[model samples]
Target: MTVLLRSSTTLAALLLLLPKTFVLGSVKLVMQNGGASQCQTLWAKHTIAVGNVCVEADQRNPEQLIVSYETRDGWKLDDAHLWIGRNISEIPFMADEPADDSKRSVQQQQHQDQPYQKQQQVDLTQFPYKKEDLAGKHENFGFVVKLQHLGYSCPDTQAFVAAAHATVTARSSIRNGNTPTLQSAWASHIEPMKKHVLQGATMINRINQWQDFNFTLVCDIKNDPPEGAPKRHFANQVPK
Candidate 1:
């Protein structure tokens, strides 16, 4: 499973419209650089399987599942941040704390020690999905009603904040008048949530496999702006 997951490159690309169809499918974690996946699975007996995960769906009846991921790399995350928490409201960890001086010093030292610093590769197709490749499948915000991680289900949609880590995949929906630029911007903003999320996804004590975990992003929630306030998309973020 580890070898197969790592070898496949399509899973990490959230919005890349491949030649084949993209079915909003099961969720998976971003593949790490080392032996994290192998170590966690092999040593499962020594540690907990699920930690800080709660996406809801009826395993027996797969039809009940509304939330689904676009690709293995559902959300746009850097090498540092991968699979994040269920909902935006759930802060990953010490979200507010300033990084200690020691941590910063170590990172700087590591950079100095490295012979050659590698740059994060930017996917050309990441922002503007080639119109030709889409095959007429317009982009729209699919509602993520709930999320289910390893051991828990995050169904508390009432308090849900912004969109979390997952990427905005192509779906067969009417574009209406939605701007692609705005969509790209929104994806960029949510990219940071994945940093430090590995605590929940890595190690034997945590969920070793975040592979193919799916959730539903609730769509068409009207913000109903009053007196011509700024137009909004997500109903969850609108004020009461």
Candidate 2:
């Protein structure tokens, strides 16, 4: 019957869509430039619909980069920021931290010794972004980013965006075949919504140096909550 056919089609479409909607996780990154882009302070704050998500980030380590978050119960530390680095080992889970702070002390010592061993790198072969070249280095030892939008969501979005806000771009490589490289970049635009502020992120990358492609990611935030909704008081809730 016609109705049976329609039901079957709907079911097939949903079966294909479910996997895409479920996100593994997310990050909230706040890069606070204290008047100087070079030496500007970086804050790895937690993901918040609006305002600061972690109490420690707001109080104890007010200036440090605190990438914390809030669940249904309350705020907690979020180590998702480590994804920016090529090695997941660099940013271990909270449980991995030792009891007496010995682990942290060792990490700090190792970090002090490692200079060129940065958290990020650039790969021209992978074609991470459109015309993504090192613009310049900041005073605080970070690189200035200059890239075009790809208009599509690919593996490069995470690295490209993180390079600008967080640490260096540590991993970049070629994929598929031995070609020149893919040219892609994501564009950032503003879209106003009734209940939340919408940010449309487009990815525009060079598919093969000869052709171009595009992708989009619409980031929505509830800037102004209604009377009944819980009020967000933190100013550093922006996603990384």
Candidate 3:
């Protein structure tokens, strides 16, 4: 009877020591500046064939920011959250871009014509990417978000930054009955991750410690286009 009682106590102790939560796999963040051109340059410099993520200004509309990611085998990008503003705190509360491109163009024009207002006027903008958007393009995929739509105007001399939070899941994790749902996991981790970024935590350090990944890219939007680049035009302006 004594031996059985000891065994029961030992089992209880082990259960107490077990972690309360579990993660199916690692999530990595890779942010490259200057959009596609910058990504290409980094690949050549590092002698790598491809990159995990790329950020670039839209070719037709410089004010629009495009974020691209590479699809990986055996893993799926369950959730991707993005925020952009003068700083980290300002990002989460920024306004979301309109779903329709035409509507966004009109919004941009209105934003430009109006005088600049305080950041508090903008609403919380959710990350724009959805998993279905990447359908069929197994190799890679991308999405665009306009800065003007987010309440940032062009011709402003200040520099702004963008933060991307991606939650990836291993196929095996999904199959495991013990794993928590993606929604629950996101709810548990999002605030803490934001706190880490606000504190200026090193991403490599976090990755080594098996934490969620966060990355940022600095962007400088200028009033004048770069030399030899296409002239800037408003979305509403039609060519004669």
Q: Which one wins on TM-score?
A: 3
Query: Per-residue lDDT for 1-240 in model 2, tens only?
Result: 000101012234333433333221221222222111111112222121111222111222212222222222111121112122333233222332223334333334445443221223333233331222332121112111111222222112222122212222111221333332221221111111122212223222212111111111221121224349855556778644
What are the per-model numbers of colliding residue pairs?
A: 28, 41, 2
lDDT of 1 by residue, 86-179 (tens): 4533323322444344543334444543332222233323311122232223222222332333222211112222222222322222344543
User: Where does the lowest 10-residue lDDT sum fall in candidate 3?
Assistant: 1-10
By lDDT: ranked, best first: 3, 1, 2
Query: Candidate 3 residues 24-141, lDDT tens each?
Result: 1111112332123223211211222222555555556544556665535444455444454565454434454344434333334345444322223222235444443322224455
lDDT score, candidate 3, position 229: 89
Clashing pairs in 3: 35-55, 35-56
Runs in model 2 deviating more than 4 A are 1-122, 132-227, 230-240
Candidates in order: C-alpha RMSD to true structure: 22.4, 24.1, 26.2
TM-score per prediction, in order, is 0.19, 0.15, 0.36
Clashes of 2: 41
Q: Is candidate 1 or candidate 2 better by TM-score?
A: 1
lDDT of 3: 0.36
- Evaluated at residue 65, the lDDT of candidate 3 is 59
**Preferred candidate (lDDT higher): 1 or 3:** 3
Ranking by TM-score: 3, 1, 2
